[model samples]
Target: MISGILAYRNIQNSILNGVKIPHSTSQPLIFGENGKYYLAVFVFFFSREDIEKGLVERPTMWAVADIETGKIIEIRQTKNKEFSDASYKIKYNVRADAQYDTSKKYYEKAFAILDSCRNEIINTDRFNPEEYKHYLDMIVANIPKEYQRFYFDLSV
Candidate 1:
């Protein structure tokens, strides 16, 4: 049961520090799937008025990382229910080769289905802490029951 602060720190640090990416501005929701790690980086890009009024923002990105191998294999981005291109890379720490099937499999599958998972959250006009959790819950719920575990809210 990797939840609360430990799960948050593990996923966030592994992705941000492991992949050499800049630390995320806000918290991210982390969960596991089939021994691989996945995170939803929720972003609010609308105006202050919209935010104050509990409007959901656009451009939420879902990141899939191989934590055991310390690599970010894929990322899917969305803006106003539309898919956007995102960069995905294998960290230098993980050698991308046949010898590492467990890690490579996660990356490969993540890449293959990146498009289908975009814009998973549809409520763009209502954003709140509760809604955020609901969105994460929805994302997690969509995952196959056997491949899911350790949902947590993490802050940078």
Candidate 2:
């Protein structure tokens, strides 16, 4: 049985090894529901130096990995057009202003929970959509209301 954490790690490593171009970092969002696992990563194609210099308008890649059968069922990347220059500017301001510190802390907590429970999520013999949905609902209930919408938008 492939646990959610194992699935996340499997896909994350795949993206690190198979990305089309050399990437500096990958910030991942992982979720498990309906007896399935999802791994989503926002890939930044910037060097450490570029980020240090405050360049936030670079192109970003979205990688989604669907894990099943203890393997990656699907892995794909989508170029997000909504992250335009204006969006980057907003992101830069948000980072510099520290207004999202609370949000960041919450997200980090969620990630920690998922990351720490790898061994507990045993692999199942078959996919169970209802079971996953139930688990997903529980996960969603724990998130702050402000970030619930964003969490639901992750469809990978």
Provide the clashing-pair count of each candidate structure: 1, 5
Q: Which ten residues in a row have the lowest lDDT in candidate 1?
A: 87-96
TM-score of each: 0.29, 0.42
**Per-residue accuracy of model 1 over 70-126 as CA lDDT, tens digit each:** 244655454433233322221111112223233545533433233222222222321
Off by over 4 Å in 1: 1-7, 10-42, 67-71, 79-156
Cα deviation at 21, candidate 1, in Å, is: 15
Error of 1 at 60 (Å): 3.5
In model 2, pairs of residues that clash are 1-123, 2-123, 33-132, 34-132, 35-132
Off by over 4 Å in 2: 16-37, 67-70, 80-156
* Cα RMSD (angstroms) for every candidate in the order listed: 18.3, 7.7
Candidate 2 lDDT over 1-156, as tens digits, reads: 354545556665675566465453333345444655555544546555655755443335545555332244444444433322223333231023223333645645544554443223434333344444444455555543433334455532
